[model samples]
Target: MPVATFSLVALDCPDPEALAGFYAGLLGGEVQKYNDIWCDLRTPDGIRIGFQRAPGLRPPSWPRADDNAQQLHLDLTVSDMEAAQERALALGARPLDLDDDGGERNFRVYADPAGHPFCLCRT
Candidate 1:
């Protein structure tokens, strides 16, 4: 028998509940109770997003602090860059000082609540 194929991405956060909530809202998914120390999000495509509570989670400093590197970044495609930026900012995404040179007419970058870098690109 072949091993079942699955894609599981784990994110370390200070609060699993809060992080799960953020992703649930952003991805339009359902948050399923997993256990005391972790939470799982069931995506529409069956992908599992796992969040583990790390009391001392130190977020990466992207576009700055050359040493600390971002583990992973989610690229989101949207219709409007400005609108998407506003929404993401409202959802706890912080702006980083990256040189877009105002050249990214179709994309912008931001950091998540946990300071993970992600981009919103024009579809």
Candidate 2:
């Protein structure tokens, strides 16, 4: 048996509530505010993602490995890539590489309002 249990994945962002809200909107979760410095989203899948406030936080330079690397990113699987992309965009997710082989690719990249890079993958 494992000695340690898996807890939650915490993300560093400028605004915890905003980031938590963004994730909640995309992932079908309930947002719980622990405080101004911390917030969490508990998804239907039982995954808990935590967002912490970092006043001077800077977003990663995604798809670029030099200077500022992409520390981490989330890959969200969707039933319809096109519709998901539309929804994400409407939710303040800025498109990074949309014309990536014109749907030939398995995933499309984007940056959240907080500037963290995430991918929308076809399920």
Candidate 3:
């Protein structure tokens, strides 16, 4: 058997509360602030994403394996790619790659407010 079960994914950023709020807005989650250095978003699907304060953090330069690589990313599935893109942009997610072959591809990439890369995949 496995030695451990899945747990939350914690991200290091400058502002934990703000990062948690961003994810909360995008993922329909409840934001819980534990302290000045830590916050988390408990999603409707019971996925807990924690955000911790890391001052002077350098967010990854996504799509570039050299230099500062994309350490990690979150893939979110949606039914309407267009609608999801709209919402994500409105909520401060910068588009990294939206050229999905005119909707032929299954996923598109974006960078969060903290510059963390994430994808909005079509279901």
Candidate 1, residue 27: Cα displacement in angstroms equals 1.6
Alpha-carbon lDDT, every model: 0.76, 0.90, 0.92
Candidate 1, residue 93: Cα displacement in angstroms equals: 1.3
Residues 1-123 of candidate 1: C-alpha lDDT, one tens digit per residue: 878876788888888888888777666688976776799998786878899988887787765556667777777777767777777778787887435568555567787787777887778
Question: Model 1, which residues run further than 4 Å from truth?
Answer: 1-4, 64-67, 97-105
Ranking of models by TM-score: 3, 2, 1
Cα lDDT tens digits for candidate 3, 2-113 = 9999899999999999889888888997999989999989999999999999999889997879778889999999998989999999998999998899888899999999
lDDT of 2 by residue, 44-112 (tens): 999999999989987889787977789899999998988888889988999888865877788999999
Predict model 1's lDDT versus the native.
0.76
lDDT for 70 (candidate 3): 89
Q: Of the candidates shown, which would achieve the greatest lDDT relative to the real structure? A: 3
Structure candidate 2, residue pairs in collision = none
After superposition, the stretches of candidate 2 with alpha carbons farther than 4 Å from their true spots are none
Worst 10 residues of 1 by lDDT: 97-106
